[model samples]
Target chain A: MFELILTLVLLVIGFVFGQIAEKRHFRSIIQREAETRDLLCFNERRIPQDMFSPHVTLVCGSVVVSVDFFKHFVATLRNLVGGRVSAYESLLERARREAVLRMKAQALAQGATSVWNVRVETSSIHQGQRQGIGAVEVMAYGTALVPR
Target chain B: MGAYENRTVPEGINVSPVHPLKDFAVLLFGVSLSVIAFVIVLALLAGYLVRYVPFSYEQSLVSRAVAPWLEPSTDPLDQQRQRYLQSLADRLSSVMNLPDGMQVTVHYVQKDTVNAMATLGGHVVVFQGLLDVMPNENALAMVLAHEMAHVRYRHPIVATGRGFAVTLALSALAGIGDGVMERWVGQMGILPMLSFSRSQETEADALALESLQQSYGHVEGAAALFEYAAAETPVLSLPTLLATHPDHEDRIRRIQVFAQEHPPAMAPQLQPLPDYMKSKAKSNESQ
Candidate 1:
């Protein structure tokens, strides 16, 4: 019974560490997303007339978080050590979907019908810099146009 | 008596002499296990490091290291060509509604390929072969308009951004595994990025068409230029340009449809070239 209790305590401690790591990772991703969106906002204002399409300019934006965040988080767990790398694949997948969805929502709010020329850019911004907050920012933007 | 009691053994057994060899063996075993574990942890950390480091930072470092090895070009003919192209770009910009403080410069290349492109910071380059094939001012304008669209849309800057993003994303993924797996992620991600570039091209084309319509009276000239290009170059076909622009035939069809559905408010009034310009063209053609 004593051994059982000791094992339970160890497991709880490991779980707590995993949660803390995961939270840090999540915060970084969100902060990066905000920085990228800010950059895109700046770009929107600076577009010249030559860049503007008379028919319609559709701007779609997206962000992708690094998979390493989840990978590192899982690896840090003592019990999860030696397991297949695929153990945390689903978490990364979920993050990617969430990031893309948030971007789509922003694009929709901007009154874009369809986004063309879709391209994604990524940057690493140091935390506490005036320009951005996060380890890296991934941004996707393209002309949003109404179909003729 | 106290010292003797401390050294006493409870059982009646012989006290053996200390063995340096046995002590060394146990110590070696413990050290070996520790070394192995340390190596395993370091290996994992190294894998993560490789993934997280930005590729651009490495590229810049290498380029700086090799800067002395690169040769600088000093051809007078190239300089003259560049000046002529720059003058032409100035003329083109004077007729368009350009944003204040934005400067457009043009360069002419001696290459035989029929291609023209624009880079960020308003630098445009046209190939000599492309000039030879355009046949008329309107055709040249069409090409210029397209290149301008690329600049106005800031495609180059956006493209560089996308490239940087993908590299970082993949590098971060690389941290998740061994070298072999990281390489696989990099290779697999390339196709999606290429597709994304193709979409950007289409967007640029649409914008170019609209710009042409607004700047010129009729969208017909733009359409005619595409037709001429399609006839002159087999590579301009939709499949070939799909990476940058949609199929030429598709583009032409869309322009025609667009023209028919929504005619411009006023027909484009094309200005005749000056006598001096016409004479220059005639002389150049004879030469």
Candidate 2:
């Protein structure tokens, strides 16, 4: 009986806090992306020959996000039924967007006009196979070009 | 650089548009319903198929576990009580027309718990507390016949098989989650199992009433045990849906109905319990 009550309480907490945190993170990512829009980033590797006195360097941003109890529970159930786990979808989206926003911010701080060969990578840092996915790390990296 | 520009993409494209809660609700509903349905079907299948398993195999499987139940008592009075109870069960089984090779062994427990149960291997354990409440031998026969009916119908093995299958499924699902997930899954599984068990109780009751009519020429004392049960337990019982046994009142009403349909040709005679069985007060003092 105690375990049942604890599960319910934890689930409610996970849902409420997870939603609030996800919404806040998405809002921040959008605002930051707007602020750093001029810091162009692309997967294209080409560097323009017309630029004078170009300074090139590496810029990267990475963040790790963990799953909440409620989403984890929903995902576990989803595993049994074999369907799209929408709960984890938004978490990944938020993480990937935030990583890109951070990478753009880093380039803008370095006075870079544009970035090239931008790439994003993801890895799951699991507690263990039985313990489930504890967190995911997303990194965005690129070559920033600043004109001197 | 001359023509390329990083245009801001639209929001909320990567993630699904469905609300998480809505997704969760649908998945929970669908999964729970399927699990319940699966368990019920599996239980029914297992229950039906388990009777084909030879009774001797079940007896061997439970021989070690029920060893304590079959242990002989050192006290002379207890031995005498056990013999008397065994003789009564033997008489009941003779009239019950149990299937060939299905033997009923009655064990007398000196404990104070007012309960009796039919378990695997055709072993029935009746507690002293229950015998204390019997107003006559007919009431005692009803209790014994109810358990014997469980054996005759192969309910113990069917229930065991059903439980085994259901637990296997539930545990397989539970392996994916931690303690909380396991508990949640177990809770969902319990509802169907409870309903199945209640129906078994009702079926056993019907058979027991029939056996009582055959043995006693009427079921005049068949409801006496239930009367004691109703009086001893508080009136506030769990609803019939949640209870393992049918409600005491409902069981009594069923017996009354059965009595009306099969009236005795002569005045009903309620045989007194043996003198040794009469000392409910003495048994408690000895304990």
Candidate 3:
């Protein structure tokens, strides 16, 4: 009975904490996305030589994200019915946005008009022996172009 | 599609569009992982609960699943032997009061193992080795009744359900401990092979006895198989607790006590086992 109660408490904590954290992250992500709107980012490999100036270098941003207990519990249940895990979807979306935002900030600092040839990579890192939470690392890299 | 390729920018607008393979890959990986997990967990749960629900479906499902593995032997001798076994089962089941299930159809699988099992959809599988050892009609009836009780109470269904639940729970708990998942997975592998609860076994035994007395007017060789095992050292070495069914001696004692309380109308006389079966047993013993 005590164990059940403890589990319930942990679950409640996970839910509350997860909600607050996710909300904060989404708000920040949106703000940064708006700020970085002017900075052009392209996945195209070919550089627009006419638009491209001489000053070019590498810019990258990396971020790590881990899910809360609530999402973990939901994922476990979802593992039973099997469909889209929106809880996890948002987790990745946040991490990806954060990584891109950091990259955009770096490009702006470099005085580049836009970013091109963008790439994103993600790797999962699970930690905690008995009660470990798994985390994902998302890294965004791109070439910044400063037009003359 | 619109790459610069050393040309002038058309709109001089937004940067390149996303061609996110890695993102999709992760999504696919997560979804596939969840789907696999869901299938295993749901199957386990459904397999457990399906017994309580009555249907003719389980029988056909199991038969179809096992069809490819079995050699389709339509030999006359085999058919005759199977018919005999089925007729005996039909006779035994006619006397043994059952719930709403079909007349038990006993299948004679030509395996040299001393075992019998009752499964979903009123199917009783009798091994050739079991027929070889039975000493008399009464002994055979006793085995039949025992298996019938399992069908009556849906013991197989309950057992499978429990096995599935145990496997799922153990795997879930594995996340909390070091080196626990491996052990849990190993245990899941063995849980299905376990026997029903001791109480379920006891119920089946008691019901079998009731059935034996009703059908034959006495529980004569009800304890014959266990007695044989006791008289001779068994090949396998398993403790009573580990055995799914109760120890034959203990079961015999229970039968005797029940018999004393409710004596049969006719005193049972020992009948000799059939010569063919006896010979088979003898051949197996020598081998």
Candidate 4:
């Protein structure tokens, strides 16, 4: 009787410990981004011809989050979550907002009226077999047409 | 308190039956513990079996078994096609900045089936039927790019690992029941391969677009290529393939959105076929 009771207790304890371990593993993976910045570039043809400011042209900009940083965050989060729905949503929202703000800043810097056809992308840099990181990455880019 | 004590029943009436209750509790506890112990033993046995027999050996055995069943196509242009494919692969390697000792091989099958595929270890095969329908070099490059993307992404190996785990699990389950196990093994053997192929196709598409933007300067060709494939091929209608890559329209929309957002770095310089090859291609078209 004592042996039976002890076995039952051990089984229950094992199940509880398993659940706790799984949850802790999940929490560790669900980390948030620490810092981020935009990778910027400009193109001359993206602006309307009518907008004229001497020595000024449309500034087309792109944003590339550090592939290493973004991947680390994603992998850690992926360990906790089964699906990418929540993570991708957070990433896309942040990327879109950041892209718009950066484009506006570029336009203002050039003293232009507004930017047009702003776009964003998510891409990855593929390196192989690194620890605690994703070989895949996400990158975002947009076009900002300024005066000239 | 004194009035309540005065109202108490006789000894037998007040006392409970401890023996029967204790016996029932002990029996229930014993049965549950036995079941738990049995499950633990089975689990440990499974873990031991897996540890002893390496998964790679099983994979190779399966691969060899399947190799005999796969139908090989016979085509006359297989050699010339191979040469052209090699040249294109060389160009892609240089453009993608791949490391030394990496090799790519292309196969041309004579089958009239409208299909093209890339397997692991950099083997790419395209059916004559698919080639016959392609309108231009860019469209062809789109297909090649998609396949190359599979290689670059290492999707095939990942897929193989997943397939092995699923197969092993199913086989273990089926081993317990003769009537159901046979049917299940038969079904799984056929279905999993098709599903894996389909998933690789989708991954290739996504990676191919990324590769196109990075190497060729735009994804316009990739989008057009997918549109063409959707129109020309009915392979997507297969149940197993459909399960992996559903909604052609969704894929098109996603690719277009991606292309729009990440425009190519520079305008792509189209590479024209050599004069002799162009003439031969024209003659083939005329025929």
Point to the candidate with the largest TM-score.
2
lDDT of 4: 0.50
TM-score of chain A considered alone, across all candidate predictions:
0.39, 0.94, 0.92, 0.42
- Comparing 1 and 4 on TM-score, the stronger one: 4
What is the alpha-carbon lDDT of model 3 when measured against the actual structure?
Answer: 0.69
Candidate 1 ranges with C-alpha deviation above 4 Å: A1-148, B1-96, B175-184, B224-244, B261-287
Q: Which portions of model 4 miss their true places by more than 4 Å?
A: A1-148, B1-77, B178-200, B232-242, B264-287
- Could you give candidate 2's per-residue lDDT for residues A1-148 as a string of tens digits? 5777887898899999999998898888888888887787889887777753458999998999999998998988888788688888999998988898888888888889898899999999985667664689999999999988
TM-score of 4: 0.42
A85-114, model 3: which lDDT tens digit per residue?
Answer: 666777888788799889989999988878
- The candidate, 2 or 3, that scores higher on lDDT is 2
Residue A142 accuracy (lDDT) in model 1: 59
Q: Give the per-residue lDDT digits (tens) of candidate 3, residues B1-287.
A: 35333222332123223222333345435644543455456555665666656545656765687545444348554566677777777777777766654557677777878888887666788887788778787887778788888887777776666666656765774554334223424433443334346667789889888877777777877887777777775666577645666677788898788778877676667656455443364465568
| TM-score-sorted candidate list, best first | 2, 3, 4, 1
Docking class of 2: medium
RMSD of each: 32.6, 2.7, 13.8, 34.0
B71-95, model 1: which lDDT tens digit per residue?
2226554555456556655655665
Off by over 4 Å in 2: A127-129, B60-65, B232-239, B264-269, B278-287
Model 4, position A80, has a per-residue lDDT of 26
Better of 2 and 4 by DockQ: 2
* Candidate 1 chain A lowest-lDDT run of ten: A72-81
